[model samples]
Target: MEITAKVPETSLKIKQKAIVIGGSIAGLLIARVLTDYFDQVTIVERDRFPDEPQPRSGVPQSHQLHVLLTQGYRTLNQLFPGLEEELASWDVYTLNWTADLKWLLPGGWSPHFPSELKTQSCSRNLLEFLIRKRLAAYSNLEFKETTIVTGLLLNPNRTAVEGVKLRHSNGTETQLTAQFIVDASGRNSQTPQWLKSLGYEPPQETIVNAFLGYSTRWYEYAGNEPLDYKALYLMPRAPHQSRGGVLYRVEGNRWIIGLIGVGKDYPPTDEVGFLEFARSLRNSEVYEAIKNAQPISPIYGYRRTENRLRHYEGLSRFPNNFVVVGDAVCVFNPVYGQGMTVAGLAALLLDQCFKQHTKSNSNPDLKNLGKQFQKKLALANKVPWLMATGEDLRWFTTEGEQPSVMTRFLQWYIEQVIFLASDQAEVYQAFMEVIHMTKPSTVFFRPSILLSVMRRMLSRHHKS
Candidate 1:
């Protein structure tokens, strides 16, 4: 990893440093954004980053099936140009989501057609690896592997974060002072406790757990000929079937099969149980794809699928120069595949806020910067959070507050959208655009789309 030119410290008049905890995707993207403002950006991680595209200890779900939505894909391209081509060099496959994926929605099978909703298909390890590799081109960015961030160092008034105290794997402890600190440490972040210890109240939390769990296995699948699509999604129908599965094409001519069960009925990791769970899915496509494929790894099971949101934006008091992003603030149900995309949007928002803050002040005074950004991030999270929670609430076993009347109406309309998408290419494209986060949810309410939905509904009703 080499950079064309080094940004010398002498050229930086501000002499500010930004420290980001965790070297995962969120942290890496934050570091990338900070390089434009801060003179130095250091990333602290508890686990050493592997040199190759392989899973590390810190990211437990790296081995699972991960999809980069359209919005995230575009963001990565904007942040690191030519990344898609580079990923292709690594054998990463690119496919149009609607055209290439065979999705079995609750209404019916989604119609296959070409659309602008293209995505990259590969393991999370490869995606992280490419992002980290791209970061090496920035002279101001640094990574401190095997270093755990213990807590934050605050100002004399305890109202602003100065830096972070960290402990290395060798048992050595030190404090690095930074003008800004960001916590992107995933779902197990200790920010809440750290804030409470600093005499500040923790943000209100909302948890909506569906008791969703999944088991995944990788295989060297040489599929039988006549394979038309690159991916298969067997979605679970609520109130009737609680089992679902997906088969995705990954690098190295491999396929990753994931079996999902909701309502505390988790898929098992044992060989027989794994196959049995696949066979029990809503459809036979997942089982058929992996029935004869040679599995290359043991089944990995994960169960932390709850949708959690911390209302940090609503807090009356919060320290300046410190902000939380990614799963630390909001963790979505993985079944929706919205986590990475939301994190990407947050990073982009961080960049935007910095620009706004600088334009308003001459010396980049960050007064209320953390609070303002958190509020905006919360707004950015509105759609995805509602979408995930609304879908999760469909199951009677899901534990959460009842949906509002408006929410129920929207859900019903979305169901109609899904049913129309089964055969109508226009409706399918609009729906996919929204789900991919490239367009607003209001697209479903467009006059043309609503008319299509109404016609489809009336036709079905008359036939019945």
Candidate 2:
């Protein structure tokens, strides 16, 4: 396998090095940019990597459908020039943005569907293979598979990060040194433990988990036709039960669909049982598709997902030469398909911070690095968080945070907006744009949009 490597065109040499303690998307991305900043960049992973584009058992969400949001795509293109070209080289599908998608939201169908937002579809394994292959080309970067870091090595002051003490599959222990260390280990990250061992303050965290369960499966495409499909979302009303289903177009000429619900609402893994789950979504298209599409794998289920946030930025005493991004920072509901995109954005943020630091040869002060990155990357997650959890929380009543009247108004308005979008193409596109994060969620507040909403409200009132 010929992995393509890119070298920055510069004479400035890297006198220092960095170590990334995870080989997932976040870690890979960090290693990718570090090649330009460090003399040596090493990525440590506990799982052994496959030689091809196959899912590793280590990544829980490997086989599922991973989406590339518009903003994330743009950031990736900026960071890795010719990214789309690379994916396309391997036959990855860059389907029509919003114009071509048949996006359905709980409110109804999206408005201005095509004009509003567009998405990229592909299996996670394939994309990961291609990137790893390309990134391996970096002369300064190296990967250590089947190696796990037992803990961190701290200096005498223990105020700064230095390196990691790791144990490999062979049961041999080694100390890997680096000037900078990043804990991209994600939701299960042990950085907290390492910090405590060093007598440093632990990062503050906020967990908002309500125990939502879900199941997913993928099917191979059997034909070439327009996907004028409905995304059946069995959602909760202002004060109703929360249950939903989502179907997405993916690479390999296939479709990936998931059925999700809170409490007693999750879909079953049995073939016929899963079909019934689709049927319960109050849509014919999803069930129809399941009956027609060829199954590529057995039904897969995931319930370990919980909304977790480690606010390293909020800590008054963070390691000077360290930073954390991706799931290690803030992870949202995967049903929103924002994880990968958020990781891409976090990678972009890392690039900006490093580029400035290396360019000016500064001390790499990180007092606000974690906070700034968290705040910046979080801007992408706010809408999706509210869209997914806010709805789910409504299921058990007295379960979620009390929503304000404005929240209820927005929820009602969004439903109408969705219903209109499905019927009116212009509305559909605009709704999609906001949901896909292509446009700000506040776009609905624009003067023209408000007029349209009032018209929709009046029409609904008249019909009632």
Provide the clashing-pair count of each candidate structure. Answer: 0, 19
Query: Per-residue lDDT for 73-167 in model 2, tens only?
Result: 67666666666777776655655665555555555654433343444566788767767777777888889999998888876777677889999
Clashing pairs in 1: none
Alpha-carbon error at 20 in model 2, in Å? 0.8
Q: Write the per-residue lDDT of candidate 1 for residues 134-246, one digit (tens) a residue.
A: 88778888999999999989999888999999999999999999999999999999999999999999999999999999899999977566687898999888876999998
**Residue 175 lDDT (model 2):** 98
Give the Å shift of residue 221 in candidate 2: 2.0
Error of 1 at 169 (Å): 0.8
Question: Which stretches in model 2 have alpha-carbon errors above 4 Å?
Answer: 1-3, 9-14, 111-113, 224-241, 362-388, 397-420, 423-426, 455-464
C-alpha lDDT of all candidate models, in order: 0.88, 0.70
TM-score, candidate number 2: 0.88
TM-score of each: 0.96, 0.88
